[model samples]
Target: MLEESIRPDNLALVIVLQACGILAGKEVPVNEKGEKTMALEIGRALHYDLRTFMLEFDNFVCTALLNLYGKCGAMIEAENVFMSFVSLDVVSWSAMLSAYVDQNCGEKALLLYRQMLQEGLQVDAVTSVVVLQACSALAESERTLVIARNTRKTAALEIGRAVHADAYKKQFAYDLAVGNTIINMYGNCGVLSEAEHVFGVLNIRNIVTWNAMIAAYAEQGEDEQALMLFKEMHKHCITADEVTLIFALKASCSMGCLDVCHCLYFDIICAGRETSSLSASLIHAYGRCASLKDATSFLNELSEFHLGSWNACITSYAGEGDCTSSLFLLEEMKLMGIKPDGLTFISVISACSHTGIVVEGAECFMSMSCAFRIVPEGKHYGSIVDLFARAGDFSRVNSLLKSMPMPSDESVWLCLLGACHTHYNVELAKYAFDHALMVQPKHAAAYVALSNVYAYAGIQDAICGPKGTN
Candidate 1:
């Protein structure tokens, strides 16, 4: 139409810009590259035409361009267009704030929000929602850092609370989206009580609200409360989504409540919501409950296999001490062209350790780094140490310990101590015990293991004998 010299009206150009924005907002799949290539091209072309037609300065057109740039991950361009506007509106502020949030630039979004308020711009529900989301994201990021450092600081909690206060002050508390986000922010900050309080006072409770509360409980190890909430959600006749089922199943798994898990599994199957994720959770739940037969049946009945389901089934068998089944599943997974990840090898190696399959365990451990290119973490090394300790191969165990890139942790030393106790090697047992103590000074189990070693050596006099008795 442009080539034919047909001058499109402002509404038609705005529609074209809106279409570009929509295209830019689509999620890109992992396996595909250049997913946004076409969207960016079209957006640029339309933007140029709007400028050429002298429509770029129009507030509506500029806002649309800002939205188009924001959605396309062109925040610099979005900000430029936003600043060029002689008049700023809530929509323009919201578009920029959302772009920052979408790109995970929570700090920038918060700063922009402050600027927006300082300018005395009127805030709308959408603006409030985006700002709250930014606060939530920032709180979550801080919480992650605190958790990583093993600190109990309430910085994230404070920030979230402040955002909650602002939401109420701005009268956005009753907005369902804003309310849900506040609940989620509290949940993410590990303040489950606050999350529950928000949930209790909400005039409207959606599935997301309930799921956030349940997930908060589940994540904090309050599985019983989570399960109870699940029940309450059912009583209210609110349908559970995939997320709700996943969290509920997690709670059931933690409690080892096979009955509850079975009921949930039945509901999922009945509703035909047995997606890969829910299937994986159900398999794990059944496995944790020692209902391996049911877990296996569920795995077999699935028309498609998920890597997670395979890992869960393998882990379940390994936990049951059924090393044969675990290994068989590993072979089957390979035959089905499913690449095994670190967890798969970990489970297989653990199964081998439980069954004293030394050769197979050693091969799997080696294959983890060789074939799979997976760098073994501490848990993998611990498993191998346990394997060698079980087989009374002290020399190989010592060799492996020396070759380990990282320091030996309490579990590795404890495994060695246990092996020493089994073989009645008093000197080695004392060495292992001392190492364990060095790693963790207050390891009561290490002290007990050392005492047992002395008892087994018929050296009862060590503790009760006269002082300085060598």
Candidate 2:
């Protein structure tokens, strides 16, 4: 249309912006040089053209522009667009909050939500859902930060409960979307009782409601409760989806309930769900239950497994300290012409490390590139380093450290530090500790490891000497 020297009216412009918003984050191709024709890029171009034409932005165009910038992850631009508004509307506010959630800025979103309430904008379902999502994300992220702070994940859950109370007072609590998000937030925060309370009061239940509650129980290691909830959902005639089954299986792994595992497995199969994608989960469940016979039986039932499924079973066996079985499965995969990836070797080598099969593990590390032409990544090197470190083979460890092409990072040095503590090598422990601090000055684990090393060495100072010196 522009090539014909024509112009879009305000309605056409609104429609065009809305269409662009739909494809905001997707990487649409605009040229061969691989630049993303993202919604933000397109919207900026259109905005530039409008400015060139000296056209005033109507309310619709302005709002659409904010949505476009937010959805395309241009938060600064989105905030500028939002701040340009003279007054707040719920739609624009919700878009801003949703964009914050998308950017994982949970704290920002919640602050904006509180401000929205102060502005006396009538809360709607969209705003409530967006707020709940912010609560959920804040709950999870705060929990991670709490690991460093050694505090309860109170910030997110407290804010989440506040949101629930506020939204409930506004009569938006019973809305399915808001209710489900409340359940999810509580669940993610590990507040099962609160999550259960929300679940009980929900006027309508869907697969998501049950899944969230079950996942809550499962994630907190409440196996029996999780399984009971799984059974109770069927009583409601709610069919289990893939996510529900995965959570159920996660619970089953710890409880060693083979019967429950089989029941869930058959339910998935009977529902005509594709078993291929779930093969690894099934194998893991059986392996955790310590029922190799059952695991083998399940493997037989599958038509064929891709490389990932085989690796899953191998990893399972390795984790269970069944290194022989892991090695056998590896050979079986080779016979079937399935190439093992770096992950496969990590598990296999770690198993060997635990079992003290040093020579075989060393051979496997050297053979990685020669046999499969797969270059080892840092993780692969870490596994090998761990194998040698745990073996108390300091000569080989020192040799490997010297020969490693990649620069030593905190993990590698910490691996050596751990072994030094275990083997009572004060000198090397001091070296490793210094290297660790040099790599990451504030790593909590590094300090803890240094403390451990000092105690093990019968050295009371717990102070560092110097880098690369005793």
Best by lDDT: 1
Clashes of each: 0, 0
User: Which pairs clash (backbone N, Cα, C closer than 3 Å) in model 1?
Assistant: none
Q: Per-residue lDDT tens digits of candidate 1, residues 1-470?
A: 87899998788888999988787778462222223556767888888898889998888888888777777777677778888988788887888898788766677888888898799886777877787677666655542433542232254456557767876888888688888887777776678888888898998988988998898899889999999999999999999999999999999999999999989988898899878889989999999999999999999988887999999999999999999899899889989998899899889998998799999999999988898789888788888988888888988988998899987678888878787888887777777776777776657888788888888888874432112222
Give lDDT tens digits, candidate 2, residues 1-470: 78998877777776787888777656554553323356667888877765665553455666777777766777787888788776668888998998899777788998998898888888787887888788777766743443642233567777778878878898888788788888888887888898999899998999998998998899889989999999999998999998889889999988988898889779977986546557778778888888776776777667766676777788888888888888888888898798999988888888888888889888888778899997887777777888898999989988887788876777787887788888888787777777777766656787788789888777899475346544
Give the winner by TM-score: 2
Worst 10 residues of 1 by lDDT: 461-470
Lowest-sum lDDT 10-residue window in model 2: 143-152
* Poorly placed runs, candidate 2 (over 4 Å): 1-74, 80-87, 118-120, 142-152, 275-277, 296-308, 324-342, 358-381, 399-414, 435-470
Candidate 2: how large is its RMSD?
A: 4.9
